[model samples]
Target: MKNVIFAGVGGQGVILASKILMEVAMNAGYDVKESEVHGMAQRGGSVDCNVRYGEKVYSPLIPREEADFIVSLEMLEVLRKLDYLAPAGKLIVNREKVDPAPVQTGAMKYPSDIEEWVGKNVKNAVFVDTEAILKELGTRKALNIVMLGILSKDLEFTGEQWEAAIRSLVKEKFLDMNLKAFTMGREYKETA
Candidate 1:
């Protein structure tokens, strides 16, 4: 079974990404279960979705230290969800930083060297500058699809399945942009 934890702040399309993943997996003939947490999400708060797939998935919840992949759209969320990554798991993180309310208000401080920390701790952590990519694509809303594109590299599903899922789930107006984002994400290269 593959346990994937998608993490990000509100408005980052974390849920949408998980849905695409679930849809793609189902299309690929895997039994899938998913769970989501949207703690104060409307106000730029944290959001996460747990997805598990295999021959048979019994639960939507992913236990601590049991996730095969933790795909995070924000750097800080990656740090927060690190414990969910199992041994030899891969951590895919976006290099964008979104300061929380506390940090914005000066009541708390954002940690420095987050990428360094993750790199030093996780053996296979892939970091990408998703926001920059989205900006270049002319749509920040496609960030989630871009992330799904990155995650797709490690999965067994074909590009057609992913594109089909995206086409089915995304609205008609935004389909082209999202498709572009997904393609860009697939072509994205990870740097050391």
Candidate 2:
């Protein structure tokens, strides 16, 4: 089974990203299972979605340290979901920091060396400034699509398959921009 965990703050579009992945997996003829936790999402709380796909996926929830991939949309959320990564898991994380309630309230601290920590812990991790890319595109809502494009690199699905998934799920008005964002993300060189 391929287990993927998508983590980020409530508004970061992690849920949507997970949905796109699920659809793509299903389209590829994999038995897919998915679960989501979004308590207090509107208040900027933690949100995550677990997706499993294979010939026969039995569980929606990924066990500890069993995730094949963790696509994180925020810096601190990457830390929160680090333990879910398998020994050889790959991480695609956004290089953006969103302070949690405790940290914003001065009751807790956000780690200063998060990039270093992730580099030290994960065997294969790619960090992207997705926010900056989206901003340049004039639409931050496409961050999820951008992340999806990055993930498409590691999957067997074709660009047409991904575009079909996006076209089916996204609204008509925003389709062009989202498609643009996805292409930009797919072409990203990790150094870009």
Candidate 3:
């Protein structure tokens, strides 16, 4: 089974991404199980989604060290969840920093070179600008869809399946725009 962990601050759609993946896996006839933790989510706290898929998943929890794929919507949160990633896991980062604490408090302790830091830790890491893509797509809310698209290439899923899942969860009027974001994310290039 492939184990995945989606981590990001609240409002980044990490939970939605996990749910979409779960529905797609179910549609594909895979046995899938998931778990989530959302402490302080309303204050923009961290959110984690543990998802697994295979012929028969026996446990809903992925071991703290066996995540096969880690999708991070925030750069530092990527570091926070790095320990859970398997040795061969792939890390997909949003390449954007969202924490306002440093600037607000004048602490100046944030990592200025996030890509370099990720390279040092993750075996495989891909960084992309999902925020810009969503904005260009005329919707700031589709960042999760954008990230999910990029993840699909590495996971056992595709844009079509994700589209179906989104349609099932959201209002019909917003489906087309979300689909567009998913397509863009799925087509993101992997850096050498």
Question: What order do you get sorting by lDDT, best first?
Answer: 1, 2, 3
TM-score of each: 0.95, 0.94, 0.91
Model 3 agreement with the true structure over 57-115: per-residue lDDT tens digits = 99898886799999988888887888888888889888878865665587877778879
Per-residue lDDT of 82-128 in model 2, one digit per residue for the tens? 88999989999889888887888999998999888778867699888
Clashing pairs in 1: none
Instruction: List per-prediction Cα lDDT, in the order shown.
Output: 0.89, 0.86, 0.83
In each prediction, how many residue pairs overlap at the backbone (N, C-alpha, C within less than 3 A)? 0, 0, 3
- Model 1: lDDT equals 0.89
Q: Candidate 1, which segments miss by more than 4 Å at Cα?
A: 38-42
Shift in Å, residue 81, candidate 3: 0.6
The alpha-carbon deviation from the true structure for residue 152 of candidate 3, after best TM-score superposition, in angstroms, is 0.5
lDDT, candidate 1, 123-172, per-residue tens: 98988887688779887788888988898888888889989999999999
Error of 2 at 90 (Å): 0.6
